[model samples]
Target: MIAIVSAPTNLGLRPPQPGAVPGTAKAPEALREAGLHARLLGEGATDAGAILPGRYVDHPNRSRNAVRNHEAIVDHARRLAARLVTLTREGRAPLVLGGDCSLLIAAGLASRVARPSGLVHVDGHTDFRHPSNSPEIGALAGEDLAAAVGLHLPEIADIDGLGPYFDRAATAHIGCRRDDEHLDELADTIGLVLPADRVVMHGAARAAADVLELPALDRGFWLQIDVDVMDPQYMPAVDSPDVGGLSPDELIRLLGLLAPRAWGASVTVFDPDLDPTGRHARTIAEIVATGLRDLGRDLAL
Candidate 1:
């Protein structure tokens, strides 16, 4: 039962630069347009019944809305974290769909409840940079992974259910590339990293175990995918795009690789806004759908 959560909010971060291709604000519609409901799982008669209603996480990012009102992003993250827990409990695998890398804050916080679960984060950016590293420049997108893992951000670090957020050492990562100061420390803290090139070669399931070093808790893992993980050429609609990233087939391979089990697994694919031309969008949707289909087949459905 994969329950999809649509979190579409640009949070209105300032442009990276003029003429930069903008990330889309349209995901739910695009998902619909992809014929997802017509096939795979979740919502309106799909094989995996809709366990929870589609809720919008269209919250304001205070930093973008107004620096002083940063409380808004904190508040939203709080509420969204709690809601993610609710969705998870409803028996539908929490599939967090989002507009930015910020989605990880909520998902990572929610994962605390599923303690001892390995975090499998797939993305192009480390997302683990601190505020000091940020120097108040650029958007908050890159700083989230750091905040989620007990960094300088107090808003997320303070969540009651996710104290210490997660086992930094136990956190495993896949598809990492385009490192920044933020990601460098993030990789150090988490201590589990897989470059994009190696990830595809290893294959999703096996690579997931190797990168994460999964053992007894293989069943208990959080599955995360950042839309930017894909090559920008294949997926041109995003807040940030690095020169080298994973391909669509690679993502699909991972999705199919990671989809089958649950010892408490939460799948979050972010930055769908970066999915321009809808080629990547549809490809992502299809990968998600096919992954679910493969999961069903594996489960003997």
Candidate 2:
């Protein structure tokens, strides 16, 4: 069985401008409208619904919205974790839809609660920024991986009183673009990183196969796909767009390889507002559906 959970909160994105269109918050419905739920055809679906985020507020000394919604993000992560545990206990694979990449904190917490787990982080950005690196902590989305590993920010790092959500050795980061100044330092600290350049060199299939070899996969792993990992030309409706990403077909093929092994998965950061024509939404639905269908065949769900 597969359960679809909607986590629509832009607290992580924290658009610089207030009142910006809330497209990411609408991603769950958008993808469902494009037939994601129908394609999965499982035990059933659950609309976890959107978790409304606080208004974005800027702080000269802190990351834009990080402090403003700090408690809310934690509280919501706990709630989401409980939901994930329930679903898993019920024998369903949870397909989490997102508002931004920050939901990783919740996903990690859920993994700890449900079972030992590993993570396959597929994103354009490594999202491993430590709060100490910059006084301004703008958004949790950019620092999720750092927090997950207990690098900084106890609020997120210690979710459910468990720090270092996934063991560093058990995590594999793939498809990150080499843009951040601290990329080298961050990469050194992570378990396995298949950067965009490497993915380009070896292809998504080879890259994914390498990630699967991590010891964390022994107990299954969570698959985290941030749409920005796709080439902007192919998937432009994301919080951050980067050049030289995988094509939609390549992404699907990679997901097909990874999904069967995923204990659960989440699709994050696709903004439907940016995709006014709905072309991007439909494409995302297709990509996710194809992956889930392949996963179903593997699991015989």
Candidate 3:
């Protein structure tokens, strides 16, 4: 069965202004308001409620090596990881609704405790900023993938001494646009990579087929979907919306093809503040309802 767990955290992101909290912390509730929970419940999904986060404090003057809300994010990640371990132990596939991509830390942590796991990262940007590549790193959201692969600081990357939750050979990254500055670095790091243009050219089914062939699928994988993968024309509500991205139908079809095999999945980086009309919420809800309807159903083991 699919279990919907809300990790309503925006601590991974930098505040929009000097003193404002990111609106992404409200994403889980906003998606619920748009009928995602109702629709999924009717489809046999269970509600796992939410894991709350600490208050977002703007710290512009903090050292570059220090992540914003560092202690709070670590505490939240540990708690979130414990819950995920419990849910997976009960044989439920988790659908984590996120406030930002930093939730991947918890997911990676939990997956390590449950079993050997792989990662399938689908995002518009490579999200590879790390201490090795950039000195401007602090926000965990943008640097999540780097941390997940054990390329960041020891504290964030090696929580509980379980660093590098997903192996590079067992990781698949898809949907980054051509112009992403980190593309070259990512191409050298991740095992399987298919950029947006590649996906669009070959079609979703073919893309799915390629990913399914990865060695990672032999052990099952965690799927991370950042809604910003959709073109800004379709989904501009994320913290960073890039042009030349996928269409909504393409992303939905890709998810429908991929979710069944994933042990768990997360949907992140959709900021509600930019979407004043709530139309984006309804659209994302439908994507979750249709695309992930079969989540946790086809784990390798």
Which candidate has the top score in TM-score?
Answer: 3
Tell me the tens digit of each residue's lDDT in model 3 across 33-67. 99999999998889997899998886757898788
Query: lDDT per residue, candidate 2, 171-274, as tens digits?
Result: 88888887756577667787788877788778878987898777767677888889998889999888778898988888888898888878678899989888
What TM-score fits each model? 0.77, 0.90, 0.98
As for candidate 2, its clashing pairs are 62-137, 63-136, 63-137, 63-138, 64-138
- On residues 43-79, what C-alpha lDDT tens digit does candidate 1 reach at each position? 4322322222222233334343222224444555666
- The root-mean-square deviation over C-alpha atoms between each candidate and the true structure, in angstroms, is 5.1, 2.7, 1.0
Task: Please identify model 2 stretches exceeding 4 Å from their true place.
Answer: 19-22, 42-68, 294-301
Superior by TM-score: candidate 1 or candidate 2? 2
Cα lDDT, all candidates: 0.56, 0.77, 0.90
Off by over 4 Å in 3: none
